[model samples]
Target chain A: MIVTPWKVSGDVDYNRLIERFGTRPLIRGLLDRLGRHAGHLHLQLRRGIFFSHRDLDWWLDMYEAGQPVGLYTGRGPSGPVHLGHLLPWFFTKYLQDAFGAELYFQMTDDEKFLIHPDLSLDDTVGYTYENALDLIACGLDPEKTHIISDVNNIGHLYKLALRVAKRVTYSTIKAVFGLTDSDNIGIIWFPAIQAVPCFIQSAREGRNVAVLIPAAIDQDPYWRMTRDIAEKLGYYKPAQMHAKFLPGLGRGGKMSASMPETAIFTIDPPEAAAKKVMSAFTGGRPTVREQQELGGDPSICTIYAYYYYLFEEDDAKLAKLERDCRSGAIICGECKARLAEIIKRFLADFQRKREKARDLLDQFLLK
Target chain B: MIVTPWKVSGDVDYNRLIERFGTRPLIRGLLDRLGRHAGHLHLQLRRGIFFSHRDLDWWLDMYEAGQPVGLYTGRGPSGPVHLGHLLPWFFTKYLQDAFGAELYFQMTDDEKFLIHPDLSLDDTVGYTYENALDLIACGLDPEKTHIISDVNNIGHLYKLALRVAKRVTYSTIKAVFGLTDSDNIGIIWFPAIQAVPCFIQSAREGRNVAVLIPAAIDQDPYWRMTRDIAEKLGYYKPAQMHAKFLPGLGRGGKMSASMPETAIFTIDPPEAAAKKVMSAFTGGRPTVREQQELGGDPSICTIYAYYYYLFEEDDAKLAKLERDCRSGAIICGECKARLAEIIKRFLADFQRKREKARDLLDQFLLK
Candidate 1:
């Protein structure tokens, strides 16, 4: 299984990912401690969608002891936001509310421009503005949330990035990202820019403040590199809660915007998104006759995974749907039709909120 | 000869440097062309101290055709400003005055902080302020000159730097700078920062502006790299006029601030500076009896070179001094004592101007 911040393919083994990324799995005991500190557990945590962590317990411990902790997550604005991109952002919003934490939403517009051969700075920055609306739709409190665009907010970020760059050797960058002499210098220099928000709070406040990064496990390498030099630079190593990727509606792989049929983009018309869900891959028998006799497997069904990952918030209702699918009480066509309507409704609401978000965009941006 | 932006050693052959740097020699024809255009030649150009050119003809061609051209040069503010550091700045002032071009004086404080292992950001930034005073003391027109501190003006420069970085590969930087994977990421990223001012005017004016860089020949590599990408980025290729180095007071190398006795720093007390000139290495026979018959070698004299490089502006006076030294008519002690007074008087006046520069510093600074 391969996973990187830029690419993800093949069938990922979540258990193996924990070891490969060198992150601690969010075990039951830690989850209990987290639930107690947060007062109410986020759905992603309760369902183990956020499966791994780095120093997360310490962040919660700080919160328990009455110290303020911060939340940071980023989106690379190369294209339209899709459901797969929202996994961590949704969790981030939940944390902001539960922990009463200040939030920093970083838009990696520069990264998107440098990495995409055809993209101009204007294209990426345009996408940054488009993507920020979706982030606002995630229900993050505007009062505490600040969206930071790398290109626009670079005046403040560049200074902090320099401190990070000073300590990082090219060898470390090469080893961490598998970059070589042929790579463009912009990408080679970008990890330091990516590491900025990890220390931004402390840099601004003139005092130490704990920070937590909620992102996909694919991004753990960046945090690992940041952790190595964080304390040396007089800032706390940022804590992280790593979430699992939401599988595409296709048979396999993480949902990507490149394959429009396999992923539902936020900007896609609600009807178009609903059509995508109806044709999604599912683990069912070839015929209805065989499905009723042998029963279907919910474990490998993309439709079931979607509900478990995003749609079905009520645990009892979700479990009942899973059981009914496995017991053949729910057939593939009927289940898909229901899931499609659920998605359509969610998208319709999201699009409305996203439109309303434009009014609040300027206020939510970090100057 | 060994020369990189950070290091210069051995006896430099100025003629050989043209071929090595892939630049054309500033022949008599080009000098004549320049004199006619500017109405006169700067002292450095008149004496062949400004020895090489790259696209300087094209820049002048544009000027003759009534298109505006610009000027750029930089300082790595790692320490106190010394006489050797003034070579290019003085010539830059001449270009700004003669050509009536806007000048960009880049202070590479970020580069200094990153490259020097023991330096803090504060140290390099602090030195940037000290060095800016000396730049103003060079008599650059505050009305047309801009002092760009890399750290302070990074809001404008980093965007341009990123564009440079996008086109450059790590292999190119490694080959041009001899940087390796062992170097800090900040240093690996710095060539782009250094290349920014070459394109700054074009970026700021929202149109093409031909730029000229005046610098010691050791910094030719940066300009070569910048010239390679200039046309690709939609700006006129920056032209360069490379200058020969001023020798140290005591030894066989460029005047270096690290060796306090070998360089005359602007901040050095006038009497202490006079003492340094008194003990300066010079062309003289061991004894007065041997000196009369054998004479002396003015060609190898550090003291005579100093006068030729900075102190003596009159070509006739400089030639007469050189002839007297070679004829043993000018004794080393008598010549040094006289040169000491000239430097002492020059410094006393310079110190006054340097202090007055504080009043003009903010005006010269690029926000």
Candidate 2:
């Protein structure tokens, strides 16, 4: 929800990016009604920092040309998603509806099964279909989207993978992906497998079209490698828009699904959402007198950061909140309450969509 | 046609083999006049050198049980055939008609195209059809035998080759095939490709039956590799009848297609055949008088060697030639004349059949 500022080495300067990319006037205007779109597709201008991309103009060009581009997003389905996992899918769905881009949501169930010895074919199949429901619930177009379970769809891409394997070398793959001594052969091939979909989606039947990928910054390594291979294979490289990692309510590092308490889920009740925010990590000084004189550091405070990303999208409102928090004018408790209310409304609508997606699962599976 | 005695190190010991694996008098007498039974197929007894088989009993078992076991043979299609190539097809045809085994004869046109870089596809295709005529000319049953070119029939075996490649390792492949640094990847895979036909002829709807490959001993390595793979793949290893290599009428080595004068071709005119023999390499002493005085070494005399292999089918007659050859009583020139006469008679029937085959070239294409 928030553009979590990244540190290359030491200090995080959020103002530099505001100056570089600039703020969207339309996003500033739509602060209250965030998810609504004027056209068939809805584009949510992301404040989250997923990755720092090089070429964003090509995606804008495709959008301007009325070309049929698509939103390609996937999950490993290793486990139920944390709050961190929702960032890409939500952003992807926003772009899908906003630009009317066709969506391809791949459930990497086979990859999970290959990597996780404990996972069974039946178990992974069950998990992948269930996970598809969550992604669909996030508002991706059921008719326009292709939610692929890798094993079931292996036949479609088997020949292409072999062709890709022929062109790539072991040395190149290792260097690009940062593969270490313990990496499995399947993992080495997994990147190319992912790259295949990026190339394949751009073509209807072997003609190159344009594409855009919205994903977390960590996944940029795979796409970078994909960029190198695209021209070699006579396909276009997809432009990327990366959102920054959302920190857990516990603060510091990115939110992890493995530790459930630190991250909130859409399925979580209103009461639980309110309770989680109240106990969130804070940056206020201990003494009441000292805290009143010296305001909290909103940069270090997880609750204030959440408001900037999710609750308050207007630059003026965010600037006022940052000033009040730093000057000890607004307390952390009031900010927490505001975030809890915003999160509650978001979850209620998301949960309703989740229920509708479950009913439509059969329609997606039909031929 | 005479039994072409294929030599490894020296002359073939025909009399010794006649005592070793020859049919019993009663069996031989019954086979010589046995009428073709609709339910029971028979393997026609060819010449003496095309003897010493591994698993003919299983095929006989299948036939006795009223199951159809087809026959298969192939020509290399490198050039116009010498006398050595004739005996195999001659025997294959006799088996097809006499025993009613459905025969499939392959012309390795694709292999020739792969191996001979100077050859155009048109040249190889033209030569294969031409050689198919030669094979049919050798008296093979046109209705019973299905003759095919490698290029057309390659798809039948490609699936089997991929399956074989997955099971074999690079190290095992290198060791078995004598592959060196400069060999092409195509050459490395050539053995697996070759082994596919053995499996194809034996498989009916992917079930492995039995196959009998009648080739010279030098080709044993191919079968040995096939045998190892056959067991691994759960298919029956092709049973083989390893014949000895026929000596060239030139120097000490085997007859090569590159040397036009060393071997008697089916297309060779009578005068040319006679001249080739008269001037063929000899193991005789200084002069005709000395040859008569000192006796000839039949082991080193190409003229008498051809007689023992091809023209002299009468066991007692071959024995007399051998004895006369060793005693210096038989002149090399006199021996070549008798052999040439026999070869000329064989080519008369061959040319007539070949002429008929030429008329039905389209029939061989199966297009």
Candidate 3:
């Protein structure tokens, strides 16, 4: 399946996408190399969720050589923040703590308004604040993180957008985004806005600073274009770490805000989240007795996938759960109940942090 | 024969352009209608230099009904402000003086930087200040004028540009500017920047105000697109008054800074202006004895055009000059000398005004 900035569809093949995108695999030993500098590898990195990269080794080399590196990642605030949205941000927090790098968290309110005809500026801006609370709850340091909404901080971005826009051609955007004549000019122009943050720190410091972007693979196209023009604009090409998508609860595709029932929003109450988890699709036999006699497939089960992706951090415990399911020792009902309890506990903690984040919002906002 | 926002070429037929663009001609009685409010018609209107319009009568009607009206005009700042560039600004000043309207003068430094690959942002912004001096020398009221360069005043313009950019589509800009796939994305996005000034006053005032633009026919495309989507955005449709181009010296087409010797810049010293005037092309017989027998054709003469357009505003004096030339009573050498004296006199006064304009620049800048 093809992954552009706006679309993610089909049964995505991660190994094939890495080859197609011409990015290097995050090899086994690279985590150890990163651990040497970071003190430890992030769960996402250790579990192979962040499986592909471009020029990351060079960026780490620069950091080890006592050069500056900044991190950039963003959210498109069309709706509430979902679990899918938090995956990269959590890793970003890890990177920040590990490398002591400054982070630029962009809320692309302008992008949402341009791509979605039904969304007004006010609507997207409201979502930006809601999404920002989730980012703050992810444990990023307020002093090192600069959370910027496109509309609120446009004064800092307009000049850089102009510089990037002047270099990118209409043909390039069309090929990258599948834009046609019917697309709004704002959409045609938005690539420049997305590209600006990659170099903004370098521009602000009046010198070249290596930019490292840790984001989902769906956003790779924007960085691909940014990387192509970065050196030409007198900055280092931004290095990217691509993360795998968290699948939707009910279906085969990634968790998306467009499908509310299939995604767990951070704002969802505990009861609602537990209900969704209980109803989520799983790979099991027709009957519990049949599943006890014939083993279920944990590899394709959403409950098992959730635990593997986020819930269970202990490798031995996760391996035991996978073995029990394959051996027909655990049933789907028990697995769902256990997953719901884990989710409820996680949400309880997250909700408290989110409330605390509200008071610190001003500190992280880019003025 | 064709005129778009980015290109103007061939021997343009004004009447045909008016027909093709679906604009109304500024007929004889409209000047008299304007005279009722303005006290007297400006020289450009009297000489039919302000030849065409779109919704101008409606704007005047709004003025008569006691509605607020604002004037908008702009420069590309790619080079020096030549005679062709000043034609519309002078007319804009006339409108501002007549109606006590606020003026928004945009210096499109960003546009020039995007369209001209060799021109840097510094180059275009440098030209903006030089062009602003020429605009101020044209006798505009500094208190009523707001001079904005795209880069300097982008903080005020970015939100409005986003609003404008969202409404326009890629096909519309491509059609209006003849942009190809190879054109930079900045050029594709620039129409929104150009369109922002038209509604800026209304946006700032928090109410609709009638906007009237005075510009050459080459800029008509921008207004055409602006007018189409204005009502959809809940703003008044902007009115436009189109002026005829000033012919270049020794040429059949408009005066342009690209052809340096053929254009007279506002910053040109009196001696240089006289030199250019002396070498100007004129309609005359080969010999003085033959010119006495065969009359010159003022219809195609650049020297005669200068007097009609700018120099000789007096009806009686201009009529006599035309009659004498047609009667073979005025020789080419004598005509050139008279034109040179007028140009020198005009430049001497303008240079002093331009020098004073530098001091008042802060008053006109939109911060």
Per-prediction DockQ scores?
0.80, 0.05, 0.76
In model 3, where do residues sit more than 4 Å from their true spots?
none
Q: After best superposition, candidate 3 residue A155: deviation in angstroms?
A: 2.3
Task: List runs of model 1 lying over 4 Å from the truth.
Answer: none
Residue A22 lDDT in candidate 2: 41
DockQ of 2: 0.05
Worst 10 residues of 1 chain A by lDDT: A33-42
The local lDDT score (0 to 100) that residue A240 gets in candidate 1 is 93
Over the stretch A1-367, how does candidate 2's per-residue lDDT look in tens digits? Answer: 1332112222334345434444212233332233344242222254434334435566566656776566676777766655677767877776776767666666666556555657655677787777777887877776778876665665444334433443455456556655443443344445655766776565445667677777765566667667767777677777776566677888576676656777887667867977888889977778656767998888898887776556676767888988988898888778788888888887787778877888987655412
Go through the candidates in order and give each one's C-alpha lDDT: 0.88, 0.63, 0.89
Instruction: Give stretches of model 2 more than 4 Å off.
Output: A1-51, A267-274, A287-289, A313-320, A341-345, A364-367, B1-367
| lDDT (tens digit, per residue) of candidate 2 on B21-119 | 342122343333332332332322433455455565565566667765666667667678887776666566655665576666777665565456566
Q: Give Cα distance to truth, residue A109, candidate 3, Å.
A: 1.4
lDDT of 1 by residue, A144-249 (tens): 9989999888888877888899999999999998888988888988999999999888888888889999999888889989999999999999999888889899
State how far residue B128 of model 2 sits from its true place (Å): 22
